[model samples]
Target: MIQRSTRFGHLLRSFRDAPSSSSSKIGGYLLASTASSPLKQACVSTNRDDEFANLDWDNLGFGMVPTDYMYIMKCSKGESFEHGQLSNFGNIELSPASGVLNYGQGAYEGTKAYKKEDGRLLLFRPDQNAIRLKNSAERMCMPSPSIDQFVDALKQTVLANKRWVPPPGKGSLYIRPLIMGSGEILGLGAAPEYTFLIYVSPVGNYFKEGLAPLNLYVEEEFDRASRGGTGGVKSITNYAPGLKALTRAKNRGFSDVLYLDSTNKKNLEEVSSCNIFVVKGNAISTPATNGTILAGITRKSIIDIARDHGYQVEEGTITVDELIHADEVFCTGTAVGVAPVGSITYQGTRMEFKTGAQTVSQQLYFTLEAIKKGLIEDKKGWIVEIDQ
Candidate 1:
């Protein structure tokens, strides 16, 4: 069984051992909500032996599953987050004129919790996510939780929903930390209040192909982000704009859409939801984060891993011609992990890349996976263990 911290172990056990009809006291610190609502019904099983979700782990997909509890905290426009609570997994009530609904004032971060073979749960580089979330909140004109509060909330939520964590090698529990302007806002500006919430889901692979090489379509007409926009941050508004290009590409029988720079339209920016890297011989290159591309946590870790393995990695302008002539290409993100690109179709021209177990992408993927699952020593101190 996974070890819980002495401070909160008993409180978490109470959530598991309580009767379904009985009230569950998550903890004094958590200020567990006992609100009686249709969607707020507690979902945890009363049986302590029920250690895992009763589902086909092999058939999991990248979608949301209502877990036991979600973490939520709120603050005003200029106030900092002080406390949060673990409430029953349910729908949240928001005003129709909320900033998030009207003006799209929100940001979100993605991370994962891996269940090791020995019943230990591991979080990979959650601090990086916290820092990024803070940056995103500033960019979105909202308040955010401190790094300590953010990491603590993540651990508490993961432990509370431990049963939802997939078994070793099956998948992982995808964690999404969201901050939004929840207060009423009819005017065209930041709301008076903000909210931070986190929810998780067990996911297998991001793409339907499941680790297979991805076929990407280059989108030259549509731009994912501009020079001084929210593209560099994890703003909620950045994604919807790319949906048109992505949907069109999917209809054309492609895995995802790769975008080019808005100014020149000749340089590669990134894929719809992940960062891209081109490999030519022992050299690796990716688009630099120049207020357009998101500095992905996975992308940064992969670059460090590649350089540590004696590969010369560069961050600069990668033109379409350079991408087409590259030996190998891959994309990285929390959801996609490291996915190799088999072919890129740019304006009726198709360019193929090297893939399979023998490629550099595969090597980096395995190394990252090993570090995540605790199969190898985490010399970089990226893995944070949730233990008693």
Candidate 2:
């Protein structure tokens, strides 16, 4: 095994001499060119391994289980991110006064890799995550890796940690790509240096109930995001504020907290982490991504799938009263795929909705999963199969 310090030094040297060329495209994003460098070989081999990690695949949960390898890259304030390398998955060094630690100048993205029965791994709409990461970086005043760099690093990390990927239908390797201002700064400004890292964790399901409907509590006292803030972006700071509400709701016997818009407080925005949709008759509506709610990739795909199947999908302001009367409600995100809302309690009144296999959530969930796992032909070209 390579010594940790030696591997880190190797990564730094390779990052210094990395190239800026692309050879091909996958899922509408350019893939960085790769030569047979020893560093690259150390990251991933072209052959798949049948031997797997010793873990309870059937009892996996949505928690961190360290994989074998991770991807890391660095950039200065005024420079574009050029290159990165794979290293052992471990804790990273950060300054005591880092900008991310002080001013919260960080953003993150979540995507997943699914293992196929034939030993192939699949990534669904990774280009979308790359684009969203760029948007978040811009919002947080940090330089970001290009889509090519982002997608390539993701592929390298997943390929290097392929053994940790759960078996098909068991779970998936959760890919988390993060961009943070790691440089030290005492004042409230962006840091001088930034870091982009990707790590993977094999996860079973987001909810412990395993696809059972969620009982959400509407948080009227706390506001998740203001109208003109970083609510639309995946900023690290944006999540911390909602945790208080989430914890309080969980304490009150609810699975999660559904927050409303800060401006009116009557308009439904989203849950703490996922985007929500309300279904009535043939019409499906979700809150618009208007600088207050995240533009979730899973939410976007579900809209397309729903529209293609003759459902009228709309993105607009969905009020709290409308949610109470909806026939069905569901949430979507990378973590919570298409989870039906069993009940929503607002201001001491609870409203129930239709759940189970006959609802729209289940139908869309199956369709999305089918396309993601390559069980169906990827006509939309959303699946990016990693090179074995």
RMSD to the hidden true structure, all candidates: 7.4, 4.8
Q: What range of 10 consecutive residues in model 2 has the weakest lDDT sum? A: 22-31
Quantify all predictions' global Cα lDDT against the true fold: 0.87, 0.86
Give the Cα-based TM-score of candidate 2 against the true structure: 0.91
What's the CA RMSD of model 1 in angstroms? 7.4
After the best TM-score superposition of candidate 2, give how far the Cα of residue 261 lies from its true spot, in angstroms: 0.8
lDDT of 2 by residue, 107-221 (tens): 9999999988899989999999999999999999999987767887888888878889899999899999999998999998889999999999999889877899999999999
Q: Mark the regions of model 1 whose C-alpha exceeds 4 Å error after superposition.
A: 1-24, 27-48
Candidate 1 lDDT over 80-169, as tens digits, reads 776565766766767788899999999999999999889999999999999999999999888888787898889878877888999999
Q: After superposition, how far is residue 130 of candidate 2 from its true place, in Å?
A: 0.8
**How many clashes (backbone N, Cα, C below 3 Å) per candidate?**
1, 1
TM-score of each: 0.89, 0.91
Cα distance off (Å), candidate 2, residue 259:
0.7
